[model samples]
Target: MNLLYKSSDESATSYICDETGYYLIRLQSKVSEQNYKAAYSAVLESAKTKPYQKIILSVIDDDENPLSVPFSARSWFASYFSPQFYKLAQNQVDVGIVKPKTKLQTNMMHVILGVVEKTNIKINAAYFDKEEEAKEWMKCPT
Candidate 1:
């Protein structure tokens, strides 16, 4: 995995593209609007050459393992409404693993997962705990 890009702002974020063309996005803190734009920009730039429409998103809280943290409602809505997100989510599959340590976190993840699934756009997406399993789910069979 090579460091494709890093957007260190309120949160230290790093995006890595693995050998199988799967993106692994790691975040250390809460996400900001700027962070979302930068992230999407990075992926869009990469997508120009290699269609890495698959992503493994891992967000960590405190000393815990990598997990998914809820973006603000603004970001959530943006994901569904933005043209950039449309480009990313359309015909794309992203694997999300949010190591939820709290009930609220788990609920939030489920809610976001549901929201993503219920979107009008067609995208193959799901949440998982194991990175390997997520990668396996994202790949097309040879």
Candidate 2:
């Protein structure tokens, strides 16, 4: 896979293997609400340029993600993730979230997923505790 973009703060990075349709996103130790948008946007931007837009997002977050999401940020987050997920979910894409351990982010992620499910959102996504398991689900390259 070739690196497509790296954030200036080193909080997020993206890579794509054009030949295989595998897109990898690596989130560093600390991730803010904006970082999530940045990472997802990076994937979407890369997808726009690809010939076929069937992307497999292999999101690796070691489960120890020190997510800095203050309560005041919740409203903005709801607005952000919903539309973002809607656009991606409408496409032929797969999302794999890899969390190696349980952390504050895990519960938050579950809350997000729960809302998506309860609202009957159509997103092909799942959370895995291992990178290999997540990769297997997304058909990510080894």
Candidate 3:
């Protein structure tokens, strides 16, 4: 994995995995809503450099605490950012998400995934307990 971008506060980081050919976004426990947005934006910007077909989002933290965004914010992002992402990838993108540890965080992810799934733009997404699983899934032919 090659580091593509990292937030100023070190709350988030983006990488391009050579093995899976997927853009990976990792969020730390300290990540905020603003930093989360910036992280995705950074990924989209990096996508311009080299088009990618898949993305893996790792909100899982090594410790107990994990990244969690409010339902409203997640909905807003799905409505606002998904379109830009779809366009940036030329109308297609698959996403593999490593689920958070806590129930609350996991529920929030389901909501965001629901919002994204409801959108007109087709953004294929799946959830996994581990980043390795997501990577394996992402590498398969779509």
For each candidate, give its TM-score against the true structure.
Answer: 0.64, 0.64, 0.83
For candidate 1, give the lDDT.
Answer: 0.57
Whole-model lDDT, candidate 3?
0.77
Name the weakest run of 10 consecutive residues (lDDT summed) in model 2.
51-60
Worst 10 residues of 1 by lDDT: 61-70
Residue 60's lDDT in candidate 1:
52
Clashing pairs in 2: none
Q: Which ten residues in a row are the worst by lDDT in model 3?
A: 62-71
lDDT of 1 by residue, 33-111 (tens): 6665566466666665666656666555543533333466335444643335457545655555645455656666567
lDDT of 2 by residue, 97-122 (tens): 67534466667667766765565555
User: For model 1, how big is the CA root-mean-square deviation?
Assistant: 4.1
- lDDT for 48 in candidate 1 is 59
Show pairs that collide, candidate 3.
none
Q: Candidate 3: misplaced stretches above 4 Å?
A: 70-76
| Per-residue alpha-carbon lDDT of candidate 3 for residues 104-140, written as tens digits (9 for 90 to 100) | 7777777777777777777778888888898889878
Candidate 2: list runs displaced more than 4 Å.
51-65, 69-78, 81-89, 140-142
Q: How many clashing pairs in candidate 1?
A: 3
